[model samples]
Target: MWKYIKWGFRITVLIIVAAFLHYTLPQRDIVRITGTYNRLTEVGANSIFYASPDSGTTTNTVDRRDIRFIEAVYPDGGPMVYRNEDTGWIWPPYFKYDSSNLQAEATNAISPKDKPEWVAVTHYGWRLPIFSIYPNAVKIKAVAGPDVRLIPWVNIVVLVLLGLLVLMLWRMWAQFKERMIEPAMDDLNNTLDAVDARADAARDRARGFWGRLFGRK
Candidate 1:
């Protein structure tokens, strides 16, 4: 019974461990797809980098606010996206497109081709990311970056843990068999030996009584 109880406990622990690993192992994969796009630039130097949304005041709703900073500037007038070194969030500048400045070839003026129906800045040498944002939302469009592969690592770790659990279960069963079953078998053997000794004594007594009564010698 004690052996059974121990075996049950091991099985229960193993089951719990397996369940916990199964539930907690697979986490959401966060891939770092953006990085230092450009250095920090002055607020009004090239174009206005918009951090605040055009609509919907965040004051009463969530009370969330975003802080703006300068990252970098270009020697020539170019559309550049700057990201904070500490935080990976990209903050692009917001600019009013002027057709007259475009025709006059002004330094800060943005062209319509570069401003693809969005709050876009036209910089000749600058490249825009594949991601886009709307006026109401302050979402930054992201292009390709480091491909953080998560599924493979997750699978390998989980498989290794599962293998360990199986090995532990095997070892636990062996221990239970040795401690519980082997001891019980030894006790059974001892009881059988006592019964055999009693039977032999009874037969000897009966034989001696009969010989004495008959007086054969």
Candidate 2:
């Protein structure tokens, strides 16, 4: 029962870590730009997913802001909309202040469905329409075609560093046990043995004194 419980906890932790990385890490989507436009959208509870307001930008009493949208389609002709916004010095750490430039690029890269021109959009977020959350586009570049391949080198390097960090922590713990904890325990055991020997000697001396006083062997 205890072993099963331990395994279940480990699996739960692994799942949580995987989900966090999936949301935080940058991903590439090979999409074809169909349009780019701005809309005055209301920012509500789901504003956490959106970028924060830029410095010196005023907000009305109502939660409304101008948000740029990038309309695109996947290779399989599926629609995907991304929000182009300035992630000004805050969460996700893109430090992207080039929403206008990205919008311009998106507009120039626009191609019709018949003459599809693929573009690789690098972004980091989830697009859950249920929560009105769209992935924030960080950068976009024109690609050769829809079948252009992208290797996730960033993820590979990050995973390697994470593995090394875990290994280093494990080694540090092992060294602490070997160099500090084991020696302390050994010293405690030796002190206990010395105490037992002294007690035994004292008892023997007392017995000898009592035997001589009582004229016994």
Best by lDDT: 2
Off by over 4 Å in 2: 54-58, 181-217
Worst 10 residues of 1 by lDDT: 116-125
lDDT (tens digit, per residue) of candidate 2 on 1-217: 9999999999999999998888878999999999998888899998778776762123554588888899999999899999888877777777888888999999999998888889999998898989989998899988898888899999899889999999999999999999999999999999999999999999999999999989964
Number of clashing residue pairs, candidate 1: 12
Per-residue lDDT of candidate 1, residues 1-217 (tens digit): 9999999999999899766554334332222211122222223322222333332112222323332211222223333443221111323222322322222222222223333212211221122344321111112222232242324474587688879998999899999989999899999999998899899999999889998978876
Candidate 2 is scored at a TM of 0.77
Alpha-carbon RMSD of each model: 18.9, 4.7
* Model 1 CA deviation exceeding 4 Å by range: 1-155, 215-217
lDDT for model 2, on a 0 to 1 scale?
0.88
Clash tally, candidates in order: 12, 0
